[model samples]
Target: METWKEPQTIILWIIIVALFVIILLTSIIFLVRTIFKKIIKAKEKEAAIQLDYQKNLLETTIKTQEIERHRIAADIHDGLIGKLTALKMQQEITSKDQKTIDALHESITVARRISHDLSPPLVEFTKLPELIKELLDPWEQHLLITTIFDIRAEINDTEEFKVQITRLIQEIITNTIKHAEATQMYLHLKQTENYMALYISDNGKGYDVAKNSKGLGTKNIETRVQFLKGVYKVKSKIGKGTSNMFLFKN
Candidate 1:
């Protein structure tokens, strides 16, 4: 049978071509899979970046809200407190009861002074350090609190921000005396070329900052910072103390 016609050399060539085609297709599939994987990784990275940006934005918003609350607090302390104290004094004077005259006068003076201490428009007229000292003086005897202020450089001379800063300081000081159960506190004001920083630290029985669910004061502070486009942070250690920082851009 003529050695089976040598199995046809052309057929052998066709078989080789078919094998080559199969190999080529397999390589192309692998290449496509790799490209798809790379695309998926890129998308995942992009999503992560977006998530981080959103988180930062949310934090900033919360801080702004805190600032607003403090501003309102300051306003009430400044405007309403003084007006009410003045009225109280007037009422006492008109009572015509000489027996209580001395007591009434003393009480009215105390109230008026408290009002002034709580709400100082010193931002309109004086430097921040001086205003801070005047604000804390009244409470020193009551709390036995030690306050230390460290100023690295002259702070921003901007007038509009002074009132806001003073308000912030007052709030923190009140919180420390009323809640922190602390006997000592330290305040540091630092001035940089681009930022103004305030550090309020208290040595007291500290509490958890994260576990606060209904803390209006905390929320208020956070909001105000955000409103001013500042950085706000509260660091507290149980049984140790608490440190709060506010950094505003100049």
Candidate 2:
């Protein structure tokens, strides 16, 4: 009877020790998991703050650039162009040399074009489609451009917003002309009450987006898209073509 009682006591002690070990391990695992989760959350929060800071910095820089552009445009239009116009008139009145007159006229035209490029006029009053059409006219001499506008509602946004969108389109066009080496381009603008969409494509020699996305032109497009609080996607395959789609919530 004494031997049997000793064995039962040893078995009970072993069971108690096993239970204690299991509980200790579980608590340790739970504590470790909690610590890991907290660390992850803290890292995510820091990353978010850094992202916000970068965005704000970018916004401020772009705004400064726009202001400088406006100032330069004003100076060109109000000072240089004005002086050029006066010179052209003087040349026209004082001289009959056709070549000289033609030269002055060309200079004035070039200056006016530069001024227009720097800052578009009457952006607030002009409809978006018309503004885009004007921007494409000069490029039409270089490439075949087809535009389809399905504007169901007016984009009564601010002048600054319109300017940014216009600049975004301009950057795309410039990139296509400079890099794509394509002959034809397409633009489709659609706007509704809820959103506005822009689709641009080119028949130019396409590139691997993953490789060239870091290019300055692409970066400019991305910055403008972010500034507008819009989303964009690019699809490109070498030797095929490239297309970009931009959507802005209204």
Candidate 3:
């Protein structure tokens, strides 16, 4: 009986030790998991804050640029263009050189064009389709541009929105002319009750979007798209062509 009791006691002690070890390991694992989760959450929070700061900085910089552009346009229209006009008038009256008058007239036209490009006047009051036509008419001399407009809903028509849209389109056109060795361009605008869409494509020598580094023009397009809370996608192939599609809330 004594031998049996000793064996039973030994078996009980073994079981107790096993239970203690299991509990200890479980507690350690739980603590480690908790620490890891806390670290992850902290990192995520920091990333979000940093992103907001960068976005705000970008917004401020863009607004400042627009303000400066407006100021410069005003100066060109009110000061330089005015002076050019007066000079042209004086030349017409005093100079017999038709060539001189023609040159002065040309200078005034160039100044006016620059001023208009810098800041379009009464943009908010203009219908978007009309404004786009006015913007693209001058470029017709450079490339074959085809446009299609389908409107079924009222647009925001705010000055800021229109200006951003205009700038975005301008940037895309400038990039195509400078880089794409293509001749024809297409623009299609569509609007519904819920959203507006813009499609622009060029029959130019397209580059691989993944391989090429984005230039300042691309960055500016991204910034303006973000400002408008719009989404855009670009597709291009080496020898095919490039196309950009943008969608915005109406």
Candidate 4:
């Protein structure tokens, strides 16, 4: 009864230990992969939430801007323009100097122009395409630049749509002047039965879009496009040119 040792029993015990170790490692690997997948999903959700927040912020900001512009336009009409008109009238009646009267008149006209520009002309009577044309065409007289608006389809626009579209085009032109320094710009619009396409391009000196993506103008464009539920593609590089193409499915 005291002589029960066997080599086969020792080998069997070794095999069982090896199997246990292999099983443990497999379980650990499986657990690690599961944890990694969860982490990735959590990160993706966080990113989506952040993007939503940013979009909301952008909408609020644009609305606030419109209010401020309206307020400023009222001030110009009721305050500054009023005073300037009164001064001009007094000069015309009392002053013998034609030059002084002319100067006051010019000041009044300039103030009115500024107010009109601040509040984009998205009037009830004006269509969006016409408004865009008016907005871009005037720059040719003031700047050393040429702008072309090629409209392939007539677009019926609501006031709200006109406001956002007007702002987007305004910001794009401002950016072109500030960054592109190009002398030529073109805006193309095409509307089909189901979708609409817009293209804006500049022949100016371009910047690295990757590095300049956070600019206010770019952000404004992006926010408006998102509001429109549209998709955009931008191509830009240094010393080359910049182009933005937008597509909207109705």
Best by lDDT: 2
lDDT, residue 237, model 2: 92
Worst 10 residues of 1 by lDDT: 114-123
What TM-score fits each model?
0.58, 0.88, 0.89, 0.71
Residues 6-114 of candidate 1: C-alpha lDDT, one tens digit per residue: 6786678678889999999999999999999999999999999997787677666655644665576576566665665666567676875555656656665665555
Error of 4 at 236 (Å): 3.1
User: Any idea what lDDT model 4 has?
Assistant: 0.79
- Identify the superior model by TM-score, candidate 1 or candidate 4: 4
Which parts of model 3 have CA positions greater than 4 angstroms off?
1-15
Please give, for residues 1-250, the per-residue lDDT of candidate 2 as tens digits.
Answer: 6764798888997899999999999999999999999999999999999999989998998899898988999998899989988887888888867898888888878787777777989998988888889888879989999999998987687888888988998999899998999999999999999999999999989998888889898899999899889999999999888999999999
Judged by lDDT relative to the true structure, which candidate is superior, 1 or 3? 3
Query: Candidate 2 — which residues are off by over 4 angstroms?
Result: 1-15
Q: After superposition, how far is residue 194 of candidate 3 from its true place, in Å?
A: 2.1
Write the candidate numbers in order of decreasing lDDT. Answer: 2, 3, 4, 1
Task: Give the alpha carbon lDDT tens digit for every residue of 46-128 in model 3.
Answer: 99999899889878988998999999999999999999889888887887578988998899888887888789888978888
Q: What are the RMSD figures for all models against the true structure? A: 6.8, 2.4, 2.3, 4.4
